[model samples]
Target chain A: MQMDKNSYKKYADARAKKSPCAKNCVCAFLFGGLICAIAQGLKELYMTFLKEDDAGTLVSVTLIFIAALLTGVGIFDRIAKHAGAGTLVPITGFSNAVASSALDAKGEGFVLGVGAKIFTIAGPVILYGITAGAIYGVIYYIVTLIMK
Target chain B: MENLIRIPKPVYILSSASVVGQHEKNGPLGEYFDIVGDKDDTFGCDTWEKSESEMQRLALSRALNYACMKDTDLEAILAGDLLNQCAGSSYGLVSFETPFLGLFGACSTAAEALLLSSLLCSSHMTRCAAVSSSHNASAERQFRYPLEYGGQRAPTAQWTVTGSAAFISTSCKDDFAQAAHNGEPVPVITEAVIGKSIDAGITDANNMGAAMAPAAADTLLRYFRESGMQPSDFDIIMTGDLGFEGSSILCDLTATEGLDISAVHCDGGLIIYNRETQDKHAGGSGCGCSAVVLAAQALRGIRTGQIANMLFIGTGALMNPTAIQQGASIPGIAHLIRITADIV
Candidate 1:
């Protein structure tokens, strides 16, 4: 491509040599959907032993535990490498993020290492997620009052 | 630093050596390396950073040994690495009595060291050593994530080469018949161009090749225009660690200026690893990428009479971890060094 100086970035982006492939997308879709289905199955299983809402929460806890364990055992990243976005589906992704950061920072000493750096990746998600949720709640309240 | 100009006097590379980790040892040029770290890629060190420094130390020592020289014989050691404050070079070469000059060119450290060493050898010093190293583990911990982190690297992400290469450069005018064994062909630095830092507005640290290709292109264009030399004039035109994406961009970028180097162009990043088996998506990168390839492959080729002359442009992304976190685009630089076999 005969690109001008200003268009170098566009030109470079056009030559996306190894972006996630179509196969990767399909794998992510399959893997992510499979995780959700398994979570659903776990929820139903928990429902037999607990209340309906408590079962849903228990399923989430189980998923996070599994993700953290996989990360510590050095398997989650390996799977992420091939699975691509498959492993990045919210609950699992968030768990992996926190666990990975904690593992990475553990060398510096617990107080500054694991304690301070545990939320390095997940911190931004939580901050922004809560902010957006509060804004949504306010809009929902206003909308409900106007409807009445 | 001299830019787009020939050195006042020729500097001959008498000897060189490469030390790599297990991954590079298992690479295509694996056997070409002088030494490889153990199965853990630690080189018997407790930490990855220390191992990186150790690689630099081993590289310089081996280079000196190959040249039949001693540590005291070295006038200076020009070494650098991809670490905070260039710790790899400083700590690794502390045992050497030679005066140390620490350098920081990111991935271009090796070429910058070689370029400066060549100039110093030609003018004032004799037996100047140029060493640069980068460890995958160390670089990852510092630049991206920790060793045990579970996030996947992008397909465009390049694997850092855990290796170091050292070159012994001396003035060709100096006499050294005693150390010259088997009448081996000497590798000489003929010309060099210091790269002007150029930012193509690329911010994705994972895709460094794209960020650096512009700098490589700029330097090559200058060398071609100033020296009035075509790419065909040399046996090969090589880049440091532009990897797959950067290599293609370089070819295209240069073509835009009516200079097509596709025929004679080669990349150190692509030369070191096997794409088929190794999971390195864009191939190997880092200072050691070009350093080892030049030592193990290019210099060997020069010694064996396969390549009479070649242009080596070492590309580097100059973004620090903090700068990337602040959303600053990566600015890249490529230092060019031309090497040839002595006619004698």
Candidate 2:
């Protein structure tokens, strides 16, 4: 059916009225800042709970790994729904994915099943990092050696 | 907040069509190429003319072709275009027996169609709805052309091609659900962040990337905050074409924001017409660029479980003579759609 211009404008206006918030605003900044704060809190908790000398340094890294793991298991996603990226952006999200995948396979047998499966999701991340690092390392070493 | 609403169902982008490269190959629109100076020998006529009725016929036919719909099915069309009165869409939709709705968002028209169609299906307003957009080369020519008949064109401005795209959204039935082995549908649109691209203080066509980049970054960052999701939560985060310049600028801006979500994002415009094959100076634009990619590639991947969850972002440059005359900057807008696979 042909919609008259007035009706069309009404629809367009209605659609615009229903659109999401303008991107630049105090709320966006405050909320986004809040997510960052929670992530920092998680890092501090990991450091104190682990009680390692390098705890502070390791906490952020560990949390990211844990978060990625939970993402794999599908549980970090639930946490994310509640905390937003405040929970997911940290290292714990990665760990959740690894742990979930391993747990899923625990019934099969520990050594071959659970132990081997932990890396299913984490493996790619590790592989890419190591490979990229190695390539960069080699390039650096070559440049240094040539200068010498 | 009362005005802003969200759709609860996944709307599949079934098919998209583009006349960008097609115009260069052969068409009545080919004659206009002489004015633009076939510099790279790869110019696609972005502008063309067809009677309002003719445009409607071609657009509807393209939409139907992609939908794979039969004459007897109970479906409806949600279509839009840039022309005054939306003649292209109205005429095209008239031929169909199905109910139809006409809409306009200037350049943001297609996403509006998709959003409205998804809402209709989620609320059970209809079982299936089709959304499409079209831009005629000749019609755009008359709009931009001078009264003197011939005018020198800026190298950076893109030609608008006539094209149409459509998708079918069907209800999730019990039997289909059982057979598919799906999860609770990922929220199709938990949140959306819309941004208007204010003229980033530039008018040169080469700087469109800069003009549209802020809008892209603004919507994406907002979506992340409101939805409480990290970049990694999504298997892929796709943006409608911003061309090469805009894509890089967007990436750079996101990085500067400390968001660090770059590993999984891509622009639809950069991928649509392979630069190697078509050798487009920048990349495809117009409504069909994103529509086609979502239907043919992104949605297919999601349905097959290739990606668990995806975020599709469509961007548009809000350019009008009034704004330009007022010396106001061009503003841009972006809308995000999140789609997840449901087996059942």
Candidate 3:
């Protein structure tokens, strides 16, 4: 039987299993919150030994290191599978994306493989992040100048 | 005149072998596979691509061994994989002395290869081997992401199966026909129907089942129309790499076509993994997913006198990273082959 694209999609959508958004959101909230709570605890502990700025920087470093290492050992993706946006919303996801790409490309060689592909997953985020920030900066600049 | 090309003579499945990785080995059809890979899923190769090639080699070698034939016995070998330039098949079959033909049917390579092999056997060649494979790590690196990438898999996303299988087909001339004459059941290829590529405006690469289901439905409808066969004529209708999502979509799509195939539909993707246990969200995919399942499960059933007749519909989504990025929707194809134990 012949079908237009719209009808085909309708048929597919009717049969295809829908992702449980409520369950996924709940899982993401709990896991993402837990990650933040850990970061908060780590910052408090680091604050005891160093300056506040240094401690904050160290927290970021620590999280990135743990995420990258966990990715290398192949534990991060497993958790991310269940955590969904929870693991991804945090700084850990960025590190996992980079580290995973680097590891994946190590076979082809350092230059073409690792260097070129290191940012493959995270490239869009960086590109859009910077572009959006610059646009927001122009808006802020124009508003502040008028205020002055 | 109908898309049906009835084989002038039967090309029976002589032997086949399956080799799989840790994930597949851990699944329900674990023991059915001929060979299982190492703990690292490397299959004794240093790289994922090489491991994939090695799987093809091992499976073909084992398949030939089971038939008590050498590489020299094959008139030609047809191999295909889901890699750029079909690297796995080209490199995998290099050592064999037989003439080689490389194919690229995405997940449908197994069936495509079989179609060619059957044609060759029915025409001139006495024996031909069809090898199809796919590796999860290699497929991931090429198509989606790194092996360790912490990206959450979509509910519609299918897990590329790490497996390979070789099917050896021989014309029913002398020795091959002996089993049938001796009153024993033999898996025989009766007819084949090549399908047209169909696009359903699906853009998500993860939901390949949706993209390919329409093509499968189109092919099934055409096969039914041309051959004058109903869904119940066959004991089962086996499909390649539709997984859970594709299988359901296929049923619904065909249902709309006024063909009720739900009662007899079995998909390679769904049978390979347990939904409750394996996190293969939708199910297993790739050329190997269907190839190995057909080699290990379906063939075994036919040999054991369980299945009388069956139809294999190899479904494939012909999309690449470049086209997907260029805003091109995935086009799909499904090739149909009728295999039967009953010569009548």
Candidate 4:
């Protein structure tokens, strides 16, 4: 059907109502910002609690992992709905993805469910790393042996 | 910075049904070709069982014909489509022994795949990259079922073409690298910004412009701010098919943002089919509309030195049947790619 100019104009006008506005921005700035700030605070507390030299790094990673796990419980989806990309734009989002998958699958069977599912999002990274590493290692061993 | 990398080879582009005559009949775009009568092919996606995957395979085969490496030589395949699971891309890539990464960015999937591939190449993470996109009318049938297997459409709703596009990116010594920046290759991506339109409850497909315009504006504005470049600094600013309305809305929105970008802007939907010829109501749909235009038209323009400093923005309505079923509004996203000539 040929779109008449008048109808097209009406469509265009109706469309204008759906235009993106700063008010409807989906990136939950406040909530995501609060979560990040809290995570930082928790990291500091953990570092101070542990006197070990590497405690800061260790504690931060642990906290990030735990936060990601909470996000995986499907709770983070609600938070993300409210926060839009705010929840997604952070490292915490990645954690949430992995944790959520693992939690959802945990009911299936621990080995395949909990263990395998936790790495769903990060699986590609790990797979590539291991495959590439093996290939590089084999090449290195061959080259060294031949040179000797 | 003086050394530049060229995508080592050219990738051949192939379409399943290249309706090359004005009165071509019985394809996804058969009706369109009959009306338009241009020598251009109305790539019909109407008949293909698995249109997306079929087109993807066809496109990849075409690329392989032009590429130096055999199918086995490819390290991995980066592919996507405007479908759930990126089904077309995944199923197509599955045939190859190489690993695959499925991506979805609505219409921007082609560029997204390329960008990721380029990043991997620039970082020496991969030796080669291939990116492709496809659309099939039958696939739309399974998904949208727009008209009753046969029915009339409002001019606002566009007929999705069944077509696919592919390109190969390889690392090669850059000759154009030297002349442009005195030996330094310009970055393929000087900057990139992704923006999404917040859903405002508009459902009519014709008004996609209003739904997607904000994302386009936000990204374009962000690109200017981040790159510290003005609108005129680039030769052309191309947007993925926004039809006539979205294009206007984008222009208006840009003006509101205090950025005047009227002179160097265009849209894929408006340009794909000559309105005088086909009268494609609102314009083209499906991922192939933008992908084919970028590969066949935009890249040609850049290669011949007809254009420089091109900003290609691919827009997508992040709406699904599920969302529409739930009465949720449509949210759109636009991804930008900055490509410059490697003038030797």
Candidate 5:
């Protein structure tokens, strides 16, 4: 029953067969690109009826709303299963997180359940994001004052 | 070396029940489950934690019902879950009014509970119930990522089962008393091999199958050697929630020991889900993964005379996030229990 370290390592290596990462990567890239293309198309359609800044904000809002709705209906999870990181790494992913937590905590009532648990995933993103932005603004002000 | 402990008296498994979530309900062994729930009705509770607790309660209640026993008749309930401080099981069984023993063996809680309950029954103790459960959302939020995050999962990552299983184990007195009325084959707990914690220096948190594979192989080898039994002795040898990768490693490691179990070897993780279709990366891995499969599928297989004997090796990765983040190697354990249809 005694196995040498070399043979054990070899056995471990044999067990750790690589999964189909290349195929997944290609699928992710293609699907991710397609999502961006659709977003751009939406932006273009909105630009014709609205100003540039309004269209930009509206496009993001539209995408997030769509993702949240999809998550609420349980479609986003199905998409995420096959889409992999393509569905993730986007604003849609953020909306899906918020929507899913809200749905999961819905039975606990709005105050303690949905109110507290809704931010379970997105809380860190907002906290660190604002903190980093404020810190950068302070550094920029200091550098400008020194240059002047 | 003296790992195998033979039961002095017969410990009969009277009845069992499995309650699974939506995904598991759609799996291959879906028909075997006692109760299947939808995604929204996951245990019909408020929170995922509460949902998991409800799963355990329902499973235990159903199992006892199958045995036609009430909570007052049981000596103690041995149960556990893949949650912080075993909260799922404790909260679930608190209302049952039965004495409880909460165990923590990670994914191997099923076999651990069974082994302990069987030992108690074999020693002339009153009948005991063994239960274990895991919720996908609850386990995911605690261990990896929350559902909403849509975090990119690695292929090594396994889906935690949202299910629970319970079994009623009694002494020969109760077994014979029941057999006079019931015509089902009595599945007896014959022997057990308690495993030692084996560390293979595996650190990846996602790749738990590999982390626990070495422990399973070690336990199986020791069980065969100590009990003086060979691979062909049992109809089937089952590993608890090892998934695909771990099962392969188990096969390779046991092969090196000159024991070929390829023909009869099976893994609960692998059998619980369809690896190709279900997005369950490697397969299912949780306390409920093996527990539900064993309670529903394997136990039924034993009862119907499809399988005469089986060895269930419950494997677990005994590493918390703190241990992993602090660079501690993931240690694994596997406990073995032999269940047979034939009377001893």
Candidate 6:
């Protein structure tokens, strides 16, 4: 039962089949690009009648709403299955996570279930993201002052 | 070879019951289950944890009713869940006032419970119950995210079954006679092989099928080798919840060992759901996945003489959120039990 590291590694390599990385990558890239293109087009449409800052925010909000709606109706999960990281790396994926958690908790009750679990998935992402950004900002300030 | 335990006396599976959530009830094996909860039947519990306890309570109640016995009639109860510290089983079966042996083998808890129950009944000459459950809400919150999170699931991810199942085993021959009189034939436990932990160094928590497949292959090979039985000896060799991907890996690994079980092999994960129509990417995984499938479907097949003998190996991935976050590999284990129908 005790195998050497080399033998175990070789055995694991033999037993674990190769995943279709090429297919997965192609799908992810194409789907992710297409989603970004759609967002770009939506922004363009809004820019025609709105201020530049307003158009950018409007486009992001529209994408999040669409993603949440798709997730609520169970369509986003299906897309994520085939799209893989393509659908996940986009802002829409974040919306999907929030929406799914809410829908999942809806059965328990709106207050404890939906309200509490609504940010379960997205909460950490936002928390770490802001922390990392602040840390980088402080480092940049120190570096600039030291150089001066 | 060291892990094998051959039952010296007959251990009769007198009766069993399965209760599943609405999603499973709509699946292919829906008709085989004893009870199917409605969409809101979260047992009216406010939390997924409480709902999971309700699932176990209901499943045990139904199984006892099927056997025409109460908690007083049972000597001991073996049960567990996917929750950390196994809160589901403790809270669920506490009211029964029966001595409980709480276990945690991830999704393999069902097989572990059943195997130990058979041993206890065979050695002590008493009746015991083995039960296990897993809820989609509870398991999801524990292992990954809450259901409402709508995070994109990896294609390799499996759907946790929202269900529970119970099996009543007794060494008393009179129980078999009563079971026969009631038109339910008993299945005898012949042997069990305990599995050693096999870590294939798989790091992805989402891809459980890959993490657990090696352990399943190792256990199946060991069971066949130690028992001196070929794949032809049993009608079917089923893995607990390998789903599509893990089942294939198991087949390929076993084939390398000169055992070809592709034709006689099936998976509980695959049997519980329709892959094409269900949208369950890799299929079902969890304690309830195999427990309910075997209780409701395979046992019925054996009782009706559709299946004569079966080798069931429950596979489990021994990993937690802390291990995954620390970048530790998932270690896996599998336990095997042989069940044979008693010829009338």
Q: After superposition, how far is residue B266 of candidate 3 from its true place, in Å?
A: 1.3
Q: Which candidate, 2 or 3, has the higher DockQ?
A: 3
Candidate 5: where are CA atoms >4 Å away? A1-19, A98-148, B38-41, B179-181
The superposed Cα distance between candidate 5 and the true structure at residue B192, in angstroms, equals 0.9
In candidate 5, which residue pairs get closer than 3 Å at backbone N, Cα or C atoms, i.e. clash? A97-B148
lDDT by residue (tens digit), candidate 6, B1-344: 27679988989888899989988888999988988876865877877888999889999988888778888899999999999889999999988978899999998989999999999998874899999999997898778875544345656778999989999998887765545345545688889988778888777777788778888888887787777889998899988999877888788778988999999999998888888898787889999998999898888889887888999898898888897888788888899999998853
**Measured by TM-score, how close is model 6 to the native structure?**
0.84
Candidate 6 stretches greater than 4 Å from native: A1-91, A96-120, A123-148, B177-184
Q: Best to worst by DockQ, what's the order? A: 3, 1, 5, 6, 4, 2
List DockQ, one per candidate, in order.
Answer: 0.42, 0.01, 0.72, 0.01, 0.34, 0.30
Give per-residue CA lDDT, model 1, range A1-148, as digits (tens).
1235457777777777666578888989988888999999999899899999999999999999999999999888888876767888659989998998888777678998899999888899999999999999999999999999
Q: Is the docking of candidate 4 incorrect, acceptable, medium or high quality?
A: incorrect
How well docked is model 3, in DockQ terms? Answer: 0.72
Residue by residue across B261-302, what tens digits does model 1's lDDT show?
999999999989998999899889999999999999999999
lDDT (Cα, 0-100) at B239 in candidate 5: 92
Which candidate leads the pack in lDDT? 3
DockQ of 6: 0.30
- lDDT-wise, the better of 2 and 3 is 3
Instruction: Give the alpha carbon lDDT tens digit for every residue of B1-344 in model 3.
Output: 57887888889888889999999998999999999999998988888999999999999999988877889988999999999999998888899999999999999999998988999999988899999999999999999988888777778999999999999999855555432234457688889889788888998888999999988988898889889999999899999989888898889778877999999999999999988998899999999999999999998888888998999998899988999999898999999899998432
TM-score of each: 0.91, 0.55, 0.95, 0.59, 0.88, 0.84
